[model samples]
Target chain A: MATESGTSTRFRSQTADFDAETGLAVDAALAGLDALDIPTTQRRPLASRAWAATWPKIGALALFLLLWQLVVWSGWKPSYVLPGPGKALSEFGSRLGTSHFWDALARTLVRAVEGYALAVVIGVVVGVAVSRSTILRTAVGSFITALQTMPSIVWFPLAILLFKLSESAIMFVVVLGAAPSVANGVIYGVDYVPPLLVRVGRSMGASGFSLYRYVVAPAALPSVLAGLKQGWAFAWRSLMAGELLVIVPGHPSVGADLQNSRELLDTVGVMASMITIFVVGVVVDAAFNTADQRMRVRRGLVAEGTSAVRAARGSRGLGVAGGAVDPVGSSGDGTMPPPADPGAGGGDGGHSGGAG
Target chain B: MTAVRSDTAVRIDGVSRFFGSGAARVQALDNVSLDVRSGEFLCLLGASGCGKSTLLGLITGLDAPTTGTVDTTNRRAGMMFQDSALLPWLTAGGNIEVPLRLRGIRRGERRERVERLLAMVRLAGLADKRPHELSGGMRQRVSLARAFAQEADILCMDEPFGALDAMTRDLLHDELERIWRETGVTVIFVTHDVREAVRLGDRIVLLSSRPGRVAEVFDVDIERPRRIDSARVAELATVVTTRLREEVGRHGH
Candidate 1:
């Protein structure tokens, strides 16, 4: 018994030493790999990356302005009908200094935020509900798609009739237009969560709300975010349409200013208002794009560098490629393949066959 | 055969599972019964359609038997799948903490347990690394740590290392044997690899496919820390392979 105990102790210590040595070896190898000029796919500094991303967008805007100026010079229409780029820029510069323009912008933004928030809440609730129940899904799944396909303009007339040309009318149209898309996003996202993950969660004793909260929600996040982005675009469009159709007495909006400019034949003001709306849309979309990019980066779904760097890494095959590695034990010595009778077997035969 | 010994971690009595309905109904398990003894590493060996994973599902309570009863004596079983199935959004440490959090373990205690489990899996100081950042072997080690975190008496592993390379699999076998010996957890491991069964199992239960039923049970009686490539493992694996081939041949008609 004394000899046995001593032997066991010695064996235990030996194994511990072996493990520590392996750890050190792995660390050293990793350090070596880092030190080597393997041309790491490290991203550029944030400032440079931002500059790289922004310059093209600025160039596109300048090109668009130049094209407009050229179109005016060619007399595509009279300057009164299609104002020159200079006339529009001057009008925009003048509008930028006015408190009225700022107020109008703020009101439009507030209304968009309010309507979009309402749509998001409704969309998520409906989406989760529909995804969870086959009955609900069957009843309204196609109906939601149909609603999304219906133009936001179609809802404005009904909303105006219902709310009598108030701010609520605009909000109602916006919500109707955006909510369906958001709900569909949630449904699609929830539907696409891998069955393996769901089984894993269930095996871990998670059920009902806990399962949805912990497993389903996180897994479905990318899809949900995509849906939210689409919903915001719909909401913005619906809000603009509503503002043009129904002028709320207290709500000074960009759409109202556009209408006023059109009525007074101040074509440059109309163009400036249109530009302001376009810029606002682009800015909001940029915010959503940034959020999406951040999520993708966190998940390692997207490379951490500019496209040029990614392309370089791809060509050189220097970066860590996606996909699970081949089995470490595989010696290329062919083992007996799994039995090929599908009717009599589980589905893992193909998986093991490929590995072998 | 032993009248459901008190030490049995899992008891499946005359259980049969059938999938689909009417014309499509396929019998996956046919009147199969097994009693996994506590603290024994038992391997369920079978061909592809032999209901190995299905039996594991029943044992883990992920699925119920169409007939008969699967009794676990209210003991929770932690299961590891072929795929790591670690939550992609979580860090390695965060993944390990999942079951503990599910069990309502306090944050401080959970963190401590996560550290200890990671160390046990030889993945120390990798708590904050995301799943994608880790290699396949490392990810699986994190998964093993997560399975251990459930603190359950029984561990059900369905080809957990089947996807790994041979070298990694061998290393993990040593790691698993070590942990199993230390923890004394009743492990019901399912695998098709004959050598793997010989290397790890205290006793191996072989199953025939096409309405999977028990073909034979062999007590390895081999000493601990058996190497997969060792002569003893190879000899035993040859015998098991002969029987497995015979079982497959019977279905050839």
Candidate 2:
């Protein structure tokens, strides 16, 4: 054995260079470990991944349109009262060229964004308060979840009574509808953080606020994201309901357009406005999904692509895949490594084919 | 309480731990005592319910004994759990940086230390990769690096290689030995496998199950640079295995 260096205050920086013979052995072993690690997937290009994600959604949209056209062909209702897919598309296409249409769309989008932002803030505050205080959790925990299950539209009458038929009226209901889910999400995340992580953090001398900030909070993030996604959906539904009922004369929104089209018996305009609402919901949901998937990838909760649990269990993760490792008795040999699979790295981007 | 030498990294004096109360009382450990010498590799060996991990918990201060004292001289034990519980959000380098950052080390030093630790674990250029991007062995390696990043005098591992396959475990044994030799850190390793204890430890403290107590302590006098499959290691492992089986066999009575 080397001379006993009893104890030191700091960790030494010279493991691989400890002795001439053993140092070389460590290096060779490390080289073999380096070779065994291959890419998680076939490493498809970025365009392929993007295409893979896009094509399925496009196909779904086409199938829906086809079904709508078939329903129109069946003549379930009068042609004037219920327009076909062709008529709705033609109306929608015609509206796209109008500055009036763009203004209404922009106003609706701005309200949605601002209202959702307010809801998130409320949710975070309520969530943190409920999570931090046992009394709050006991008093309001079940109530928060109860509020989530109650239809957001049910809040409109109370919201209008509280704030009148103004922007505040719409925002009040939106916040009420979305904040409960957000708070519950926060509470659930805090409750379920793995105890092992907490122990590891404490063992490393992280305590008090530092433990919560570095360990607990980050561990709770994935759950929090799920909450936020669900919260946004609620806010969207609430905003849509509020817009229809409490439309101010100045604020031209999609919901207000639907109301006007119905009042005027403008069948094409009504179909076009409904289609716009559907598109908005689809787009926002897609954005949330993308955010959730990216976060999951970062945590290794999912593999680089799909099949994370399998990848972890497979030979690529823990086994001797390419070759056996017995380099102990070899003489004067630091084998030049092939770095295992060269193609696993060279391919642009990765196989994030999104289960499309 | 029992007295300890100045060089003793950890001392457990008549430590016993009981869970619940009255008829429900389960004794996890019973008057188990041992001293870990500074910079030595000591293995706590037993079957399940032997309180090997419970003893480790007392040493690390994650738990306290219902009776007796665990004197660690105010030094904490950096523990490695069986599963590589790396924070999913952070990169591999970022996980190592957590302890340093918590200690309020400056940014530049933290970065430098992270690079060094990653390199020490033979995970160079994988600093940006998250836990999922790496394989099972790689995740464990990063976990080991994160443990060292805590800068503790004693590294207490609780079946850290249990999830890994044989080859990966063997690789980590080499990696761990080299790191231990270089750093001179005391290791209070817990494992069920007799061969594993022989492969890595300088000393093995065998404990009995269903109310753990120190059964015997064997000095692993095998020479350095010993392989897991080496004849001397297997021979000692055989002896330890028989003793361990005898202890385990007592439950049938």
> Number of the top candidate by TM-score?
1
lDDT (tens digit, per residue) of candidate 1 on A132-181: 89999999988998887777787766877888989999889889878987
- What local distance difference test score does each model get? 0.77, 0.76
List, residue by residue over B1-253, the lDDT tens digit for candidate 2.
1233257878889999999999999999999888888788999999999998899888888889999999886555788878887776788999999988987899999999999999888898889987756777888889999988888777899999998888889878888987887778789999998999999888999999989999999999997767999999999999999999999999988
Docking class of 2: acceptable
Per-residue accuracy of model 2 over A76-138 as CA lDDT, tens digit each: 988898788899999999998998888989988888888888878888888888888999889
Single out the weakest 10-residue window by summed lDDT for candidate 1 chain B: B1-10
List of chain B TM-scores, one per candidate: 0.97, 0.96
> Model 1 has how many clashing residue pairs?
11
What digit string (tens of lDDT, one per residue) describes model 1 on residues B37-118? Answer: 7677899999999999999899888999999999986677888988888887788999888888888999999999999998
Best by DockQ: 2
